[model samples]
Target: MTIDDHKSHLVTLGKFLKQFQVTGSKKDEEIPGNDRFFEDFDQKIDNAIHYNGWFTRENIIFALQQWSEALTPQNLKWWLGDYNLNQSGGKTVGIVMAGNIPLVGFHDFISVLVSNHKVLVKQSSHDKQLLPVIAAYLMNLDSRYENRIEFTKGKLEDFDAVIATGSDNTARYFEYYFKGKPSIIRKNRNSVAIITGNETKEELAKLGEDIFRYYGLGCRNVSKLYIPKDYNFDNFFQAIYEWNPIINREKYANNYDYNKAVYLMSEFKLLDNGFLMLKEDKNFGSPIATLFYEIYSDETELEKNLEEHSEKIQCVVKLHPGKKEVKFGHTQKPQLWDYADNIDTIDFLSIL
Candidate 1:
């Protein structure tokens, strides 16, 4: 398929995805193949939630809504506007997708195909159900996609290059295994927010969304906070109370109980609000149901510290839009251009 053909099919897929939203699923009769695929896709969402407890309905729908917004014709045009993909394709790129959140690996899946390269996907067992359903929809949209996309439960072979996302440990294995081939092996990275104590309650509420979305499973979720030395927890806790219902979820509640127990047994001080726990920690990657925090003495030094450890962070949330900093709650709503690990996947594929 030509680039425009790819764009057209993806735009159609976007429209189909738009039907399933956080508010509710609404089928649009005008969208092609809705009669055939929409119901199956809806069922797959439930299957995904059952297969992996982390894949909640709200989070899955949220992911779909974000992708629907991203895959528009205009967004596709802008995403590819600068690349010269005319003579660049037919290579097979293997992708090892992480199962941290719903549809987490989808961007890479579309990146390889949209750039004209064939894709061989090895999905995490935890997130195996949903993407295949999406792949089937794409294949139905155009038969050409059938030849371009393939999924495997076994080892990946016969691909020219690879893109793998995993923890720091698995990344080492990927690096050693794919050492000779062109690859993007991603390691663990966490997002953190910088609270200056002047944030409005509205902004803090939005920040709560960043913290609570996906049950804090995504790398983009704010796992840590960089707060001013004298920052109080009252405003922050009150602002995020809207998400207190998250505590009722068994998996999250269990984590909260376990982690809180461990901390209390160790006599570590923490601020708890029944659902979320905040501890004074210098680490960026906090445990589930807990957010790590550190008091910053100087804003300039804090920025410099974040800069020095940039590789360890996926995003830095703050009010200001400095280098590599995102707004209060937009970390999870990254645009099509927001490449993970600051590595440009499109550019990587274009060169290949």
Candidate 2:
């Protein structure tokens, strides 16, 4: 199939996803084959939550809505505008997706197919349901996709290049295993926000969404804070009070209680707001229900330190646009062109 054919199918898939949202599921009669897929999809959403406690209904809908907004004709065109897709007899690209958040590795999945290469997908066990169902819907839209997309439960073989996302340890394994082939092996990275003691209350509230969305499981979630020396956190705590109900969830509350106990036993100082804890630390990857923080004395020195540790950071949120910085509230709402880890997946696949 041609690239235009691929684009059309993805557009249809996006429209299909739009029907299912947190408020309600509205079936659009204009979408073809909805009658066959919608019922099964409704069940899959339920199954997704049952299979993984973190996959709540609201988070699933949010992920679907983001993809629905991203797969538009204009967005796809803009994202792939500079790529050459005319290569014949393309190789198979193996993708090992991460399940930290729902549909986390979908960009890689779509990138391979849109670049006219066949994809061999090895989905993370934590996220086993959603993508396969969507893949079936795509095949129903165009039989050509059936020949191009394949999912594996066993070892991945017969692939020219590989893209794998995992922890720092698994990344070492991937690098050693796929050393002979062109590969992109990703490791653990966390996001952080820089507070200059000047952000508006509304911006900080939105920043709370960056911290609490998907229960802060995704790599895009801001797990750390960079604040000026002696900066008061009263405004930040007040702005994020709305998300306090997150503690009602069993898993999150357990983590909060356990981490708080550990800190108390160790005699470490903590700032607690009942649901979340803020601790002074130098690390980026904080545990659930906790956020690590550090005080900065100078902006120039802070920038230099952050740049020095850029490899360990995924995103840096700030009020103003700076180098590799995202807006306060926009970390979770990434655009279609927002490549993960600053690596261009489409560009990587096009050359392979």
Runs with alpha carbons beyond 4 Å of true place in candidate 2 = none
Full-model lDDT for every candidate: 0.92, 0.91
Per-residue lDDT tens digits for candidate 2, residues 118-203, read 89999988898899989899999998889989999988899999999999999999999898999999999999999999987888
* Candidate 1 residue lDDT tens string, 1-352: 7999999999999999999976778999999899898898999888999999877889899899999999998999999999999988999999999998988999999999988999999999889888998898899889988999999989899999999999999999999988899999999999999999998888899999899999998899999999887888898998899999899999999999999999999999999999999999988999999999999999999989998999999999998768668998799899889999999999999989
lDDT of 2 at 303: 87
* Alpha-carbon shift of residue 38 in model 2 (angstroms): 0.9
Worst 10 residues of 2 by lDDT: 80-89
Location of the lowest summed lDDT over 10 successive residues in candidate 1: 320-329
The C-alpha RMSD in Å for every predicted model, in order, reads: 1.0, 1.1
Clash numbers, per candidate: 0, 0
lDDT for model 2, please. Answer: 0.91
